[model samples]
Target: MEWAEFTEQSHKGRASWTAIQPENKRTATDNALALKEFFQRFPEYQNRKFYITGSFTSESYGGVYVPTLTNLVIKMIQNGTLPNVKLVGMAVGNGELSADQQTNSAVDLLYYRGMLGMQQFDSLKSCCVDNYDQPLTYCNFSQFVVVDDFGNLSPNNNTNDPKAIQCGKLITSFAMDSVWATANDVYNSYQDCYNFTSLSSGGLKGEAGRRTWKAIMGSKRLRASVQQSQDLQSMFSTGSNPFVDQGALYNQGSTDAMGGFACYMDSATQVYLNLPQVRKALHIPDSLPPWVDCNIPVNSQYYHQQNHDMTPVFQSIIDSGYHLNMLIYNGDVDMACNFLGDEWFMENLAGSVYKFNLLSDRFAWNYTRGSFLPQLGGYVKSWSNYNTTSIDLLTVKGAGHFVPTDRPGPALQMIYNFMHTGNYNNSVPFSLDPQPLLPQFAAPPKPSFTRKQADRVWSLPGVTYELNFKQYSGYLNGVPGNYLHYW
Candidate 1:
């Protein structure tokens, strides 16, 4: 098929695409009814906390996953511009070829070999692993972290996967501002996962180089060959380079009839994976940058300055007699930020260290993973339960860096349990309003001083202490004393 032909085919995309729109365009009257419906369904949210998040909120994956090198390679093969590369062999399996065909396993191996940096090829090949079979581990060497204010995280090793990492960092770090902070709140606690020592002079440069990125970088190149995509079925006379490490090509796994060795993805598949991502890419005509751009019109270089953005706002919310939950969730597949970062954030919350020791409580539910899934999210009750006020780590099952996108069901369920019962329940239809958590932790009355004493201490003009020590802060004219200290 010609590029022009594929372009023409793409025109019909909008006819079938999904579009999410607000009810009645969300006017005051519409929102009033929405409010009415809200109260009708769950009245507690009225003037209470609410949250919505996902890739849509983060604006990650703009362009969806198109323009990706893999996607481009796919398109090139589809157009027949890439020679000797059959586009059809992309996703098709090398499982069991018929008498009439042989497998292009080598090519498939090569593609995954490059795309997945440190991933094991054997595990990757198992991705076509039979049903109920173990598929490849996307990034198996990853670790979980529990550190300072950043909470738990599991960031992807390859920073070059900028689209996935930066965009995730930007969105996860800031997108929930309205829910947690008011007007400019951001908190980024994600950490880099790759080992830095692997790059140094005396590090993995020698022996590890075999598995080190440098070795992989040195020994690979695809020999691009082109043929008319329209005339895809034609058999070429030339065949194998039996001596080469990557054997001669044959159709591997993709559905396209074009018989070249290739990795190709068309535009439609991308939209199906993430339509909103495509929309965002289209919106940013000049630069579909991943993560929040430095020039995001804020602190310029002070971009990931999330701590700066969030700390004061958190204090403000505490001051306003409101409850705030700073939650960080991660999807395991997301090779970007890991849950280790979220662990870091939680441990160091409120500028100090905390720990949630693995509880020996009898396991409550079936935390075991179901078929096709890997690890399920589980939580151990904090040792200091019935403890003091602070945010808690809320884990979701089967999620990735983009937790909401991957496991919105569990996430929403957790938040529902959070705001409603102040607990997380894995069970569906978990009891709502299990128990009211009317916060008894309101701000104490400000400290006071006699009129003359305040005048001497603060030196602010016209100080009048109308109320006594009853309204402690009457001395400072509503200037709140430090809740942790001034008392």
Candidate 2:
């Protein structure tokens, strides 16, 4: 906890909670060992079990490139350079494992998911007991708020009651704009459900930045949760509504009622990746420019780059004694990487690098049994070093910011009981059989103008084709101060 008591008790300042990546020519440990030498030059990826992920922890490029390419593929299987790289465990859902312990657990996880309600959680708990004498859950506020199964209060529930001196002047104006802004009210109240209106300039990831990047390339709950039930009943035969909104990630206005359910999953994933038998069953390769789900110039180059504090490369990969199992999950309506800031970053890296006697206390994992529905599935805390390396720190119940797209069956039974039998104890009853294959990608190139290089013109006066571009291949003029798109 000592980075000056985690920056004056989670005021989260000295920056660096993970960014600085913009170079892109390559290097995130050389694109994770060039994707483990393209899956060890494929042979149906032999003994496979490789799972590695990182979705948003701020202007992502898989925030810290998926945990520095899963610690350089566990330092190439502890030096033998990928000795059969089984690498069974590493999960980061909700990224940023520590930007000041997730900006001190995103202002008490938006006031325990009431959305800073209980009168702004008692005015940020009496402005942290009158300026740091302590309490507002010791300024980090920790976790709890569960209420879902349709009873409501789950759209990332930024706790609510609204008043503690206007929630201490809206948490000191979002901690003066970045202790990551106390987890930015869990992404403006649960995945941009709404409430951002300041717009004279840009902040909150530049409000409506490029129409929320063309409404997340037409998001439909991220393209019908990856299709297939008769191709999602013949491409949604009147069922598509992953929360009807398409202002793309926020700034919906005009009395914002609906617009930004990842913009209809980025416009039905550009017609399910330009169909044609799903691009010949995912081979793609026609040319390359259409599917775009939030790429405003690589999220404006990780939102104007430069950031770091990777908590000493996460305490040099758990004090590098290396054995690694680390899970560190979260979703309790994630305000992007919130699980009380990775449970105070594994209780401040188990009392600052193991000396604090291999910690372990917080528990409760619950499930109740329902292969596809029941869940409490949250709360856990573990840490060990004596037995080489361990760390759990979990939470998933109800979820948000994509914990397998919000609780995909308790996030696949808590990742198949923490990767086949390491059992993270959710009081048993998880049951797994036939549920894992959703990571397929391959189909993306083919746009440089087709259907007769389509064109048509009209300047305004109730515009016709909104200016030009008849078919597909780009060049959409739309004149007037010119808004081009030359394919």
Candidate 3:
């Protein structure tokens, strides 16, 4: 998907790329036009209230696309181009608000979540502090890397230079890969799927090797000299290898494209979607292929045509005085799109789109049980107009990139409160505890292969290393229609 490319470009100031912006915007704009036409054909449906919602830039059309579409609909209704269609509220989660801010926050979040250790953090911090005069939290690591690669930390560094940006991306990719590999150790579960494992001594040795590579990469001279990014890609590649058994663990069902934090949902959803009865009931023909969660074609198109920042679109909507409620929230643990960056994106619009600097002070949103103490659920910072708060920035604790999928209870509660009362702060009352709301029975996936299996031998390319004990490797087709494997 060239995520690294987008990440690098975003870290620079330009945000959206001219190369992809036109096609992406046109795609979304055309869809909005088609939707308006459909509604026009059905006059009876146009009178009812409608609310719009989406997640990530894919569904949200760069996080601002749906709202932009809605705005167009509103304009059409006002000008008699279409029947009146009421769009009362709009919400987006873990979506792109600001490219630079998102990249900055993502790097910072890796540190916050213990993915990037203190050593890496210190290195990046020095690069940022010396070059940008900003803390690591706010600085663009990509730009910092570019300057650091050049042996200069000057404020006036040409971060946007194509060569510099590529250099920065390569270095950033190496550092991020090291951290991501190490992150698997702490999380245990593969980010793509629910396969869980504690690395064997051999795996630990591989991890140690990865660490050594990272330590060696800490040198700017060495880092800049290394021109090949395939090295970073291969570090985490899911190939048939005995030393690194990611192919057996995560690639069996091709579920490695999923996320960590929740296993049951991932497995169970696959089960439900692939059920023949369910598929038939949902109007699927037997001729069609089995159901998959993601649309790879669409994803690829979005990636190729992905460039819009959407922050400006958000500001445009806010400045339009639409009177519609807008909410932007995310899970705190999301490395894909961090909450802090979204907060920064929203806050930056305060003085520009909002008159009188509408953004209010941030506050913690605690979850309290009647007699017991309160748990910090997350944080909230609201943006106000003349006397009313319309924009909300919030976080869900212990959640990853997908908030609802990760912490459904708090997310639903927050949604209910915002929808019913239009008060984000009033959601999740102090008297209500969220512990009971989450799935009480969902357990983490247990590993089929234990560390004790480390001594078992496998026939592979490297050597005829022997196992004193017998070893077997095969896939386990679970009742949930997904595949798992062990070595």
Q: Which candidate is the best by lDDT?
A: 3
* Candidate 2 lDDT over residue span 105-215, tens digit each: 666655555545665455455444445444456453222222121111111235564433354344433422332223233322344323222221133243343234222
In model 3, the runs with Cα more than 4 Å from the true position are 1-23, 30-49, 55-62, 125-137, 142-171, 174-261, 269-302, 351-356, 367-375, 387-389, 425-487
lDDT of 3: 0.51
Q: Which prediction has more favorable lDDT, 1 or 2? A: 2
The C-alpha local distance difference test score for the whole of candidate 2 amounts to: 0.48
lDDT of 3 by residue, 1-487 (tens): 0001011122111223334534434654565566677677866666565655654322212365555665665566666776666656667777656555655665666666665677656555444545544545566554544222211121223556655554455345433443333434222222333233322223343334333333332211011111111111111112223364443334232132322224444335657888988998889888988864433333333333244356556655655666677778877755445577777777777645464344656787764436655567688876667542377777877765556755555676677666776554454554343343256554443334443343244555665766575765555557777877666
Q: On a 0 to 100 scale, what is the lDDT of residue 131 in model 1?
A: 28
Q: Kindly report which residue stretches of model 2 are placed more than 4 angstroms away from their true locations once superposed.
A: 1-65, 68-72, 75-77, 83-115, 118-120, 123-265, 274-318, 321-334, 338-347, 354-487
Ordered from best to worst TM-score, the candidate numbers read 3, 2, 1
Would you estimate the TM-scores of all the predictions? 0.29, 0.29, 0.57
- Pairs that collide, model 3: 192-258
Q: Rank the candidates by lDDT, best first.
A: 3, 2, 1
